[model samples]
Each structure stands twice: as C-alpha cells, then as structure tokens.
Target: MRGEEMNFEPMMKMMSLSSIGLMIWIAAQTFTPPKEVVVYVEVPAPVVVTQVIHAPISTARPAPRPDSLCLALNIYHEARGEPLKGQVAVGQVTLNRAAVAYKGASSVCDTVFARKQFSWTHEDPRQPSGAELRPSLDLARKILAGRYIDRTHGALHYYNPHKVDAWWADSYAEVAVLGNHRFMR
Candidate 1:
C-alpha cells in the first residue's frame, strides 16, 4: 500500500510540471513586440493674395474760396496786365454779390429760375421773395463761391459785357440771366 501511494504522488508532480511549461510557452508567443514601419509623404507650399490702395488726403490748408477763383484771378491779371490785387478783388466781388443777393423785394428772387424777373443785372424783377429766395440765393452764393458754373460752360454772370454782346439777343432766352444792360445790348 505505501509503495502505491508514493507512485501516485510522482504522477501528480509530473502532471503539474507539464501544465506550468505549457502556460509559459503560450505567454511568450502571445506577448510578441510590435513591428517598426517607415513611410514618406509630400506637402504643398502656402498661397498669397494682392489688393488696391488710394492716395492719402493732403495736409496743406486750402484757401477760403475755390481754387478756380485763384486760377481765374491769375489768368485775368496776366491777360489785362492788371495787378494781382485787382484779380483778387474780382474774386471777392463774386463772393460778396453772392452773399447779399436778396437785398430788395424784387432782388429777393434774383437768384431763382423765374424768367420774367431774369435781368442782365443783379436786380432781377422776377426774383423770389422771403423764404423762397433764401435757399436758392444761398445755393447760388455757394456755387459762385465754389467757382462752379451751374451750366457746363457760360459767361460768369454779366460781369463781362463782351460775352453778352457776342451772343445774339434771341440767345439770351437760353441764358439763366442776361449780362448787365451794358453788355446785353
């Protein structure tokens, strides 16, 4: 009986040793290190855009009246052989007349578009009165001061009699105002 029991113990020991060896082999195969790989890729360069710019405003101060006034004064003075002061005075008068355009009731509408009142002189009979004349006169004054001729091209008021005379009397109808009587006939 003792011998049989000892034989059984050795058999059990062999079985346990075989199971441990099988487990170690399985663990080693399952835990293999990951393989290393090398790859190449191409990338493109960045793109650029362009844009227009305007000139900066001038810092130099401007004269009170329009620059045209200065130019006209220069030309008039040079042509007639007059002093610069006379040219400047001419510009000033244009500004001044524009300022007090509605002094009289008849002159009130002096700057308006009424044809009947339209005269060769500053005093137009058909000129607007009171509030009606104010806005138009004010605008006219501004235009004159700015040296902007309302029409594309025309005589500067009735100041130059020569221009008025050169145009036919019937042509006066087309003009906003005829030149002063001296020029109109």
Candidate 2:
C-alpha cells in the first residue's frame, strides 16, 4: 500500500507540472505578435504572358515670340480685366516705350521689365501661365502684328485716373480716357 501511494503521488506531480507548462505556452502565444507570411504558387507549362506599353503624347502649344510674349505678359498683368480696346491701348504703350530707348532697353521685354515701369511685373517676377491669359495673349499678338488700330492715340504712358495724387499724371498730357485708366503722352 505504501509503494502504491508513493507511485500515485509522483504521477500526480508530473501531471500538474505538464499542465502548468501547457498553460504558460498558451499565455505566451496570446501575447506574441503575428508575423507576415508570403506564399508562392507555381504554374504549369504552356502558360502565356503578355504586356503592352503606351507612350505619352504632348499637347503643348508652341512658345510665343519673345517680344510678343513680353507684350502679352504686360497686357495680361496690367489690364486683363479691361475691354479689348483697353488691352490694345496698354500694348501700344508698351510698344511705344520699347521703340524709344527708355533705360537703354531696345526690346519690348526690357521695356516691360524696366525698373519701376509695370507694378505687376515687380509683384510676381514669374511668367504668367498660358491657360489663364488667352485673351491678353491674342490681343498682344494682334498688336504686335499691327492688325489692330491704336486706340490710345500714340500715348506712351497711362494710369488709373480714379487714384489720387499721381505726380507723373500732371507732367504728361492726358491723351484719352478709356475704361478705368487714363492714357497719357
């Protein structure tokens, strides 16, 4: 009976230890993070693969002439919201300035970008985008091509008449009052 009791006790202890070890393993598995696994499959012979590539096409318009571009930018920035005649008048002023040797500028671009000439050019020193400036560009092209009549009467300067106290306004002869701006000689 003693021998049997001893054997039974040892068997019980071993069973308890195994059960505790199993519980600990289960707890460890619960706390562990899952890992990503990738699987690969093999295809049988006689399989075909195909791929097609398409090239991109350009829809950009040709760049305008340098003088015309400068004129267009000036008109667009100066009087884009003004009437057609007003825009042409602004272009005429730019061309008139270019013709003269203002600040030693022999080209329209130099005249438009001359120091203290157009306030818009000074504000943002970047070229105007082509999409938003279609009307101004067209008018500038026409003016450069000499296709439109000069509405400013050969006026070389202009300013918004609504503003107060311009020093240069009194110096030059007021040529024409078209739209919000006053063309000056």
Clashing pairs in 1: 109-127, 109-128, 110-127, 117-126
Q: Write the per-residue lDDT of candidate 2 for residues 36-118, one digit (tens) a residue.
A: 21111222224353222221212334578888888988998888878878888899989888888667787999999899898
Q: Rate the local accuracy (lDDT) of all candidates.
A: 0.32, 0.70
Instruction: Give residue 149's lDDT in candidate 2 (0 to 100).
Output: 77
Q: Give each model a TM-score.
A: 0.20, 0.63
Q: Model 1, 88-115: lDDT tens per residue?
A: 3333334433345533322222332224
Distance (Å) between predicted and true CA of 94, model 2?
0.4
For candidate 1, the C-alpha RMSD (Å) to the true structure equals 37.1
TM-score of candidate 2 on Cα atoms, chains taken together: 0.63
| Per-residue lDDT of 101 in model 1 | 52
